[model samples]
Target: MKLTNKITIIALAAIAAGSFLALAQTPANNNIVDEIVWVVGDEAVFRSDIEEELQQLRAEGSALPPNPYCVIPEQLAVQKLYLHQAKMDTIEAPEGQLNNQVERRLDYMEAGLGSREKVEQYFHKSYAALRNQLREVMRTQYIIGQVQENLTKDVKATPSLVKKYFAAMPEDSIPYVPLQVETQIIMVYPQVPQSEIDAIKDRLRDISERVNNGESEFATQAIMYSEDGSAMQGGELGYHGRADWVPEFSNVAFQLSDPKKVSRIVETEYGYHIIQLIDKRGEQVNVRHILLRPHVSSADLEKARLNLDSLRNEIVKGKFTFDEAARYASHDKDTRNNRGVMMNQKTGSSRFEMQDLPPEVATVVEKMQPGDISQAFVMKDPKRNQDVVAVVRLTSRTPGHRANLAEDYNQIKEMYLAARKQEVIDEWVEQKIKNTYTRIEESWGNCDFRYKGWKK
Candidate 1:
């Protein structure tokens, strides 16, 4: 979800520069002309590029990988290889997604840096100019990433291969596995009574009418009445596409061509909203909205709890398995189809460290053992920010220890697959270097590189 799209933007904080605008000058002295550090095919890796990347890494608190001047340039050179291939293949990044990503990135940077003016000052460019540069960078990044995915998406490791990979690893080099637990849950959102929903909808309809009649500015109304986090910014969701928003909301939002017209009530998992389109450019649309979630009455919440309690009792009495109940009854879209197993978003693993678990889940699970089903309890849903009743079962638990094939086969399989993928990429690079025109300045060729064929 682009709700935390800052993580993606923060990743680019180490991508070196704002774009070519910031890359036009070297660090420490803007007067010095940039020189080519290396040339891969038709693309030139400039000295300023290396310096900018190094500066960005330092700014992001990343440790330099021994002789950053050489390493950073090499990294840029490799990126150019993919970029070149992408161009040849005519890989086009969707403009709307690219613009939306750039907009979100800039929004995040502005908030983190304090203000839009500070962001402009930091980048040494106007907001529009900076956005243009970021859009191009994002486009290139998307193409490069797509190229890499194309190359490695089909690669897979077998159980035997994983076992062999694990056996070959030195005991001293084996990674320490943190204590992790896999959890499964059955969720039931507390039902908002129809009366409450109708009341909120009525209120929203009135607000929309008022805005339509010029009784209030859309942003002013948003700030005054919207419940979303963006209410502080007048419910301005910068610019985004269908991918970043709920389908129902996005459908109604994109259908509005006139900026002044407010959309009727739109219902989504989060709540009810009436959106006013600020502007639309290509696939990107900017909008301000007022969101009003129907309050779940105590009776409704108790109803949800009782429902879950009945389901829990049925599972305990062996009427049906927890997995079956979760699939048939759980309201969580993310885990329902997966047999109730919850995935840790950061690690992309079913297992989660205690600290990484949702606070409510963590607090309850701490007192339970493996195979223990927790009692139905009310907790705020992290995504929707609404009260939900749920019952969780600790599926599996592993103590902190050195990683081994028996208990951690999937992790070993991933490591093996990654190592193999790297080898494949290195081989591809070695061959591509030979076929493509390549030259490195002698001064830049002194450091040890992962691929030595570039020197050829």
Candidate 2:
């Protein structure tokens, strides 16, 4: 049987902290007791731990199993086994990856909750404390993942094995494929007037001049004027490889030989930037930059829409095929050369589920039929951080259907391989529980568990 879904570390930590605070505030005569529920090897699971997990589940609106008391401890125990194995095998989570994950998770939480203060208030912990707890939890998760990968590294589902796995499956167990669509798009960015372009450049030049003349610090100017997210951090983009930055930015950033000198204004897709060298390590550079983007007026947007509309009219009148127009006229570098076919980044495929398409594209495509071309519509270009006009063609649509060997061979093969890996893990867990020292509180032992040998 499958184990419980992974619990969110933030939610668990919050619940645990609230529980402890509640206990601390209770009268001395209170009867509430928290005690050890189970011991797996050298690790102990507490009653409070189980309650925290339960509270987290409730908070997240997840339905509990028949007896979560029995289920949760087993899940925790299984995780401990993987972590213990990871320790014994000397497996380590890369520090860089760990830090990046922690920061990203914290950023997501802060964004959702409105601010760092709100997150800390809800969790009843300081920002640093929450970060520390998350880091430890993320590290444990990473190590456990490494251990599992090591165990199933050699397990492969060949074509014959995949066919056998599919053949033996019950009819009701077959997976259903969702309706998917393939679309082609031609995107044209609104042209910023030359006056606006010159204005942005002039401002950057003034800022650069001030910094060079010692009238102001680069970091100060960046914090006050830069439009990029790094502005809050004084525009410091930490040490990164040359490949980390766009070609134009990197070319100028690497050429800065003097720390005090600011580079000439550099133009990139995001905007215009002026860079100051901070430091350099073997093949890596650290620089600070201020970015300014030219504003696109309503007139510019209307012009772009009309241009795209004219192009659409040409395609409809048989002046040229949609593919030809996309290849020669589209401004989006990513899809222009590929004949404007939009790829699903999540699946690395040409097909997209309705929800997976961009909001503007989805809105237009939902009302369209195969071979229908949409009118020019405006959408945000996330890469360049600007508004652009686009027209799309519904290339094809596949209706939802049951998975079959003919049309969904790759999907079936992946499912079979994943099942095989989980089977290997389950077998390993069964053996590990037998070999490890485990003790369960008698009061908590009166329920069913999917794995054997845990009662002792």
Q: Give per-model TM-scores.
A: 0.85, 0.79
Q: lDDT of candidate 1 vs native?
A: 0.79
Best by lDDT: 2
In order of listing, the candidates' clash counts read 0, 0
Best by TM-score: 1
Candidate 1: regions farther than 4 A off: 1-28, 110-118, 193-195, 297-314, 318-321, 327-329, 337-339, 347-349
lDDT on C-alpha atoms for all candidate structures? 0.79, 0.81
Q: Write one digit per residue (lDDT tens) for candidate 2, span 404-446.
A: 9987888899899999999998999999999999899999998
Model 2: weakest 10-residue lDDT segment is: 21-30
- The lowest-lDDT stretch of 10 consecutive residues in candidate 1 is 1-10
